[model samples]
Target: MNSSLRSDANTIIERSIQAVLPDEAVRRALSGRKFSGRVLLVAAGKAAWQMASAAAAQLGDGLSAGVVVTKYDHVKGDIPHCTCYEAGHPVPDENSFAATQAALDLVKDAGEGDTVLFLLSGGGSALFEKPLVSGEELQNITGQLLACGADIVEMNTLRKRLSAVKGGRFAQLCAPAKVFAVVLSDILGDPLDMIASGPACPDSSTCAQALAVVEKYHLTLSDAAMECLKQETPKQLDNVETQITGSVRQLCAAAAQVCRQLGYEPVILTDQLCCQAKEAGSFLASIAKTHARPEHPMAFIAGGETVVQLTGKGRGGRNQELALAAAEGIAGMDNAAVFSVGSDGTDGPTDAAGGYVDGSTRAALLAAGLTVHGVLAENDAYHALQKTDGLIVTGPTGTNVNDVALALVR
Candidate 1:
């Protein structure tokens, strides 16, 4: 492994994540916004805790009440008047229902003069849900979509149909009251309706599109779920005003800035990378092989979320899988390394944020009787990277824009 390259990668990761944190963004968004009566804050997703905290500090005694629902272990501390609840992510669970109910209740009796300060981010589909179907069925359907490699847009399209709070329904529930939403986009292109299933934004996706996703994935859904898919989400909403504060584009820019500071000429390949994790890794390695010049440091960056088609039962996330898959293509390159990490600081179900690979990583794994192909086939990049000391762990980054993958050549 190239220690210097690894250090640079770590610096880029840290600085970039810090740049995209929602604290300043939230404060700025709320600065000039005026509220008539009540400003009831409802924050949901991975950044819910952080966004809520910032809003609480900004609003102070002005905030009438607040509710925060975020991924488990994400609630760092208490926010002044807000009731904080830690819930499940990627799949809604019992706590998800409870926390969502609390938010719903907080806004249910809202008057026309009241304002719902809805702070939304990625993972809100699961963290801020009131399922129309049974909770068990919802979990099963979510698992099926995940296993079949449905992308975030597709997953949320189907998920919004099955939930009472998604697809602009939450905004409807907070009806008569205006909603001022500060959104942190995690999806490529920053589609407002698709982020966190767009609880407050008008859903552009149709019922046909929802059914198409189900058919594409061959997802086995309950009868009630199928019925929900046939129902159309709200096509238009007038009570909500949205301000998009951050996105993967910002994440990529931050990384590129750090790369330039590290004396590397940075090229942003794309900010909309969406494909199979393994294929993306291999493609990035190919770019490194074709572009790297001797003694001329360069950084190639791609920022977007990738999908993993699960054919194996092992544990891993898309970022981890992407990094591990790059191991073989750049195995003999002394000055090349590839790494990918989730902005949320958690990859799949593992503790590691992502994985890293360089020229020596392959050999180290082989020395431990592990082959890249074998580990990847089992979908166990977490353990494989662990054996090679290639796992990148950043616990609960308090933000979620997307994943950023980089190929470093020095």
Candidate 2:
């Protein structure tokens, strides 16, 4: 491994995550916003706890009552006047239902002149759900969509129709009251109506589109689920206004800043990087080879989410798969390395944020009886990375802004 380059990558990753934490962003979004009557807070997603804490601190006595529904282990502490519940992510569980019900109950009492301060972030679709279909069916459908490698937009489009709280239905429940939504975008283009299935914003997806996704993916759905998708979601909402706090673009910019500070000439390839996990890694590795002889050290950055098709039952995430796949391409280039991480600090079902791969990674893994193709085919980047000490663990970063992948050539 190139220790210096790895060190630089770690520096960029830590500082970049710090730059996007929702503490300051939430406070900034709440500034100058006027609220009347009762101001209730409903926070959801991986970053919900931190966002709620910062908002509670800012709103103080003004926050009448609040409910926080986040991923399991995300609630770090108590937020006064607010109840926090940790649920599931990537998929919603029974706990998700109960916590979402709490949020709904909190907002259902909103008066005509009241304001519902809805703090939203990525992963909310699963963490903030009130499923219209049976919970079992919802889980099955979600798993199918995931296994089929559906993108965020496609997944959320189908999710919005199946959930009572999504597709602006939550805003409807807070009817006669205004909803001020603070969002942290994890999807490309910052589509307010799509992020986290847009619980507060009116959904832009149509019944046909939802059906199209099911058809395109050849997803098997229950009769009840099919009916739900056939029903159209709310296309417009009058009582909701939105403020986007951060996104992948900011993540890329922050990484670039850190790279420059560390003396690497950074090039932000794109903030809209959307592709298969392995494909992205291979492409980045190819870039490293293309610039193998640069006069100065260089960093290439790509920020956004990637999809992974389930070929095996082994545990891993898109970010981990991305990093591991790059190993082969840069196998003997001692000065090259590639790493990818989810800003949320948890990737897939694993506790790791992501994985890293230096030029020596391929050889080291082979020495340990692990081949990149064999490991990746089982969708088992986590264990393979563990063998090479390549996993990146940064438990519960209290933020979500898609992901960042980097290629360092020194």
RMSD for all candidates, in order, please: 0.9, 0.8
Instruction: In angstroms, give how far residue 15 of model 1 lies from its true place.
Output: 0.5
lDDT of 1 by residue, 108-150 (tens): 9999999999999999999999999899999999999998989
Task: Supply every candidate's count of residue pairs whose N, Cα or C atoms clash at under 3 angstroms.
Answer: 0, 0
The parts of candidate 2 lying over 4 Å away from their true place are none
Which regions of candidate 1 deviate over 4 angstroms?
none
On a 0 to 100 scale, what is the lDDT of residue 236 in model 2? Answer: 89
Query: Which digits, one per residue and each the tens of the lDDT, describe model 2 over residues 24-48?
Result: 9999998887776899999998899
The lDDT values for all models are 0.93, 0.93
